[model samples]
Target chain A: MNEAEIIQKLQQGNEQAFRHLVENYQKRVVNTCYGLVQNTEDAEDIAQDVFVEVFRSIGSFRADAKLSTWLYRIAVNRSLNHIRDNKKRKWFQSFEDAVKEKKAGLLHYATENPGTELENLQRANILHEAISSLPENQRTAFTLNKYEELSYKEIAEIMDVSVASVESLIHRAKT
Target chain B: MNCNTLHTKMIFFLEGELPEREMEEIKIHLESCTDCAAFAEEMKKTLAVLETDKTPQLNPFFYTRVKARLEKQAEEKVVTQRIPVFARILQPAIFSVLLLAGIYTGIKIGQPAKINSDQSVYTENEMIPYLNEMEAEAIENFLME
Candidate 1:
């Protein structure tokens, strides 16, 4: 079905249309969340929330805005919220809890790739920590640009910022 | 270019965003300066993490899980909707019952006072006349004395 028709069907609460929407956008949504959260499981979980939100609130969606942009916005917001909520847990777990968690996480990664996964996982962890240290907007812009490979203009549209702001954020993030 | 200038432009150069001339200049500087070269190498490795940590694919069961969640949500919604409807109906009914009870209680409390006032009306009138007679008698005795 066409975009308008699909939206109409979704607004009408058609499960088929919902399934179609999920099929079309699921990977991108997960990838967007993954870019920010840097965890495959959390990314998928947040992506599910994103879809559920879209399904629940599809009636309020303005037709003028692209669905993909809305999806990305939700994914980004959800991932950031997840991070914020995790911050408390992280603070409390800064002791031996962190080490145990890291060990558990490393084991999880090791199962996927027996040999090189640990090194790559460690690199990814360091990179994620660095990205997490950045200001929220800079981190967001950089993540979208680097991980999702989105253009500055696209990031601007999703973030509702000027392209110049996105460029400046990314430059700051890189530096 | 000096190290400071090259350092500022290193990110843009690494991203291939700088102009060709500036890119060439930075490249020449990095070729000679070990410090700048090492920094550039580190930056490259950091940026490469994005490539190495490949974007994860959505699981095939993603839609199924979403569908299950949606269904569960819908079910909870039905239960939730039932409650508000009950509350919507119950709230005003309870308020109205309490209001009627209040009015009834008020009327009941007020009735005794009305009854008491009615019963005391004759006594008050009789007491006044008797008091006047006593005063009159006392005045007459005092006048005679």
Candidate 2:
């Protein structure tokens, strides 16, 4: 179904349609969260939270933009907030321990891999980690453009920045 | 097209964001200047690398978990929405009962007035000593009003 039909059904309390919507966008939301949080479990939790917020507030969603854009805006905002709050919580814990655990996990997976596909996956993971390390604004701009394939204008709108600023951010991100 | 201008617009050119005139200019520059051509190629390669870096697919259980959570939330909201009706009626009824009970209690705790030497109503004998001569006279005068 088209976005309008799906949204209309969702607003009418159709669970099947809601499930379809979840199924359709779950990967993108999860990926977006993963790009921000860099942990699979946290990303999953954040993605679930994003959908819950979307469902609760779907009634108020205006159709002025694409549903995907609207969903992305929600996903980005939630992911950034989650990261900010997670950083605060992390300050109370051992940052070194977390980093060691992550490196160990990545090393274990890398050692077990024998195929080129595994190598590519490892590289992608590294890139994602690099992307996550970027300042929040740059990371948000890059992820929205790179993963969502959003136009600079759409990204600027979602991020509440100028098109020129978005362009500069992506440029800086590339370098 | 100047190689300098084309070099500056390489980012936009790669994304196909340039106007037709500028695009034509860049295309012509790419045809002649090896350096600008290589620059465009390098930019394209970077974008290609980025393009290949796909967003990882989420685990299979992700959708199920999200759906379950959303359903649970929706169910909760439905239950919450149904609650206010009963609460609305119950709230006012409870408030009115409590208000009436309070008034009844206040009236029960209170007593009729008794007159002292000053002829002013007193709820208790302790209030008589606090009455001053002028105040007592003012009270007596006001009573006549």
Candidate 3:
């Protein structure tokens, strides 16, 4: 069925529609969440939360925006929340322990970002750390632009900001 | 064009959004400007690294896991939606009972304590402090008189 048909069935509380929704969106949602959280397990958890939230609130969706954009908003929000929650947990670590932890994580780089070259994975990690330190809006804009390959216009729509603002955000992020 | 103009358009050039003339101009500019060339190269490297930085694919049973969670959640929603009569009524019942207890206590405390304040009972935590203050006030007034 088309998206409209699927949405109608979903609104009607059809289990099949729900299953179809999950099947259709599970990967993209997980990937988007993973892009923000940088942890596979946490991304999966957030993906689950996003789908559940979409399912519960599908009735309220006004169709004013594309479904995927709405889903992106949810995925990004959940991933950011997970990062913020874990922030405090990692706040008390000693510098040596943190370095050791970084080395340990680097040891598992292949699993951390699958499909990355072994040599380039360290560079990727550094870039990810830089991106992580960006303010939330910049990070979101950059991730959506680079990872999802979204246009600045689409990202502006997702973020409820102007296109010029998205351009500025991405420019600042890149700099 | 100047370096700032070239830098501003670098992202668009890389994205292939710039027109042929502008792209050619930037390419010609990049050839002569070592700084812009290095910046472009760095941007390309960053893009390459980020290109491979995709989220790792989950195991094949990902759909199964999601479906299971949905089913479990659906079951939970149903269970919670049912809202047993006792459970539904019990919350407000408990709240009202506590509220009534508070009001009763307040009234009892504020009442003219016949066994205590006799008539000028003030609403204080304990009767002793109010009685002491009232007695002191009376003594002061008498001394003033």
Candidate 4:
């Protein structure tokens, strides 16, 4: 079916149409979540959540952009939220547990991450930490550019920012 | 280009996004300036390492899982909406009844004494004589007319 027809079907809450959407964009959503969260299980869980949200609120979607862009936007936002919540939960743990967690070392986080090569694991982990430490906009721009390979114009559209602003964010991220 | 300007363009230079003239200018500067060249190389290496394919692919049944979750959510929504209207408002309905009972009880216990005092004036035997005199005067005036 054409994009408009598919969207109409989705808005109508057609089960078959929803299944089609889930099948088509699942990989992209999952991959984007994985890229942001850096954990296999959490990415999968968040990907499922992204689709569930899409189904629940499909009618409310403004559809001003491509479906895939909106999906990426959701996936990125959700993955970051998952990370933020996890950090907060960890912070709320007892002092002894927090000390133990610190003793476990941050490198352990990378070792368990799926798709990380052992040869470059340390470097990659450090890079991940650096990206995480960056401000939200810079990290998002850098991720969309360096990993997703989205153009500055496309990233600008997805991020709802000017192309020049995206360029500056990526520049700041690099430095 | 100077080192400071070259620093701003290093990312584009590494990505080879600069215009031909500017590219040449930066290249010449990099050739002559060891510190800038080193900095550029370091930035390039950092970016290269940053570009690793670290995001894991989703499992084959990812769509199935998502579909199942959505179905479950939809089912819950349906169930919640199907709740009986009275059952949904049961808590508030019970609270309102208890509140009204308490107010009625409080009024019965705290009945005012001023209402009894008003009744005493209307029921007094002395008012009967005044009422009879007023009726007598009306009859006398009617007979005179």
Please give each candidate's TM-score: 0.75, 0.59, 0.68, 0.66
DockQ of each: 0.36, 0.21, 0.26, 0.28
The local distance difference test score of model 3 is 0.81
* TM-score of B-chain for each predicted structure, in order: 0.56, 0.39, 0.64, 0.58
Which numbered prediction scores highest in lDDT against the true structure?
1
Best of the two (2, 3) by DockQ: 3
Off by over 4 Å in 1: A110-118, B2-8, B83-145
Clashing pairs in 1: none
- Candidate 2, residue B49: Cα displacement in angstroms equals 7.3
**Best-to-worst lDDT order:** 1, 3, 4, 2
> Best by TM-score, which number?
1
B90-110 per-residue lDDT for model 1 (tens digits): 999999999999999998988
lDDT of each: 0.84, 0.77, 0.81, 0.78
List the RMSD of every prediction in angstroms. Answer: 10.2, 14.1, 11.6, 14.0
Model 3 Cα shift for residue A32 (angstroms): 1.6
Each model's TM-score for chain A is 0.92, 0.82, 0.88, 0.81
What is the overall TM-score of model 2 with all chains considered together? 0.59
**Model 3: residues with Cα > 4 Å off, grouped in runs:** A93-97, A112-118, B1-43, B74-145
Model 3: per-residue lDDT, tens digit, A22-135? 888787888788778766667788898888888889999888898889999999988888888877767987778878877766666666656766657767677768888999
Per-residue lDDT of candidate 2, residues A37-121 (tens digit)? 6666677798889888878888998888788788878888888998889778778879798788678756643443435365455
Taking the tens digit of each residue's C-alpha lDDT, what string does model 2 give over B47-117?
55455434554578876787788778779879878877788799999999999999999997896765465
**Model 4, span A1-175: residue lDDT tens:** 7667778999998888888888887766776776666656777899899888888778888868988788888888898889789889977889899667544544555545556565466556556678768887787788777767789998898889999999999888776
Candidate 2 RMSD to the correct structure: 14.1
